[model samples]
Target: MTTYYTEDHEWILVEGDQATIGISAYAAEQLGDVVFVEVPDVGTAFGQGEDMAVVESVKAASDVYAPVSGEVVEANQELEAAPETVNEDPEGKGWFVKFTLKDPAELTRLMDATAYKAFCDNQ
Candidate 1:
């Protein structure tokens, strides 16, 4: 599996044609204590960079964008009752959704782990 990241701080863990998506730990930390998350519904399709979900925190509410276009295959229903998981495990069980990638080529446009770390360091 390969992982990619958007400048907006969302990450996608790609496995075959499907990818699991989530906000990065940096984004979760910046957002502060997460209170709620609104994940996109299964079967929903979105263009790359589209607003796919909402994450609310004590600091503010933020839109979670699609790092790559695709049809939503599953959403983390566990978030509705345990949004704090985002703060605790932003890259793990806190994952927001899984989707079938619309264009696998799009993955090439995102940063890899090394590049993403450098990008964040500069920010």
Candidate 2:
């Protein structure tokens, strides 16, 4: 699996044509104590950079955008009852959706881990 990151702080773990999407740990920290998450339903399709989910926290409600074009295959239901998982493990079990990539080429526009870290540091 390879991981890619968006400028908006979303992460996508790609494995073949499948991908798991989530907010970065940095974004979860910035949100401050996530209270709720609204993930797109299975079969929902999105273009690269479109808002695909919503996360609400003590500090604010934020939109989680698609890191690349795809169709939702799964939504993390665990978040409905325990959104704090985002704070505890934002890059792991806290993931929002699993989807099939619509265009693998789009990934080239994203950042690798090193680039993402530098991008965050400058923010």
Candidate 3:
């Protein structure tokens, strides 16, 4: 599996033509205590960089952008009732959605883990 990061702080873990999507640990940290998560429904299509979901924290509600264009295949329904899972495990069980990738090339435009770490460092 390979992972890519968007400037907006979303992460996509690519495997074959599917990717699991979520915010990074750094983003979860910045968002504070999450209280709600709203994800796109399965079968919905979105463009790269589109607002695909919402994450609400005690700090504020924030948009979660799609790192690449794709059709939503699955959404993490568990988040609706237990959004704090995002704060506890942003990259693991806290993942927000899964989508069928629209363009594999788009992944190249995103940052790798090392670059994302550097990007976070600069922020």
Report, for every candidate in turn, its global Cα lDDT versus the true structure. 0.96, 0.96, 0.95
Off by over 4 Å in 1: none
Residue-level lDDT of model 2, residues 100-123, one tens digit each, is 999999999999999999999999
The per-residue C-alpha lDDT of model 1 at residue 114 equals: 97
Cα lDDT, model 3, residue 72: 95
Q: Which residue window of length 10 is worst by lDDT in model 2?
A: 57-66
Per-residue CA lDDT of model 1 for 15-84, tens digit only, reads 9998999999999998999999999889999999999999998778899999999999999999999999
**lDDT by residue for model 3 (1-123), tens:** 999999999999999999999999999999999999999899999999999999998868899999999999999999998999999999999999999999999899999999999999999
Clashing pairs in 3: none
lDDT, residue 110, candidate 3: 99
Stretch of 10 with least lDDT, candidate 1: 57-66
Clashes of 1: 0
* Global CA lDDT computed for model 1: 0.96
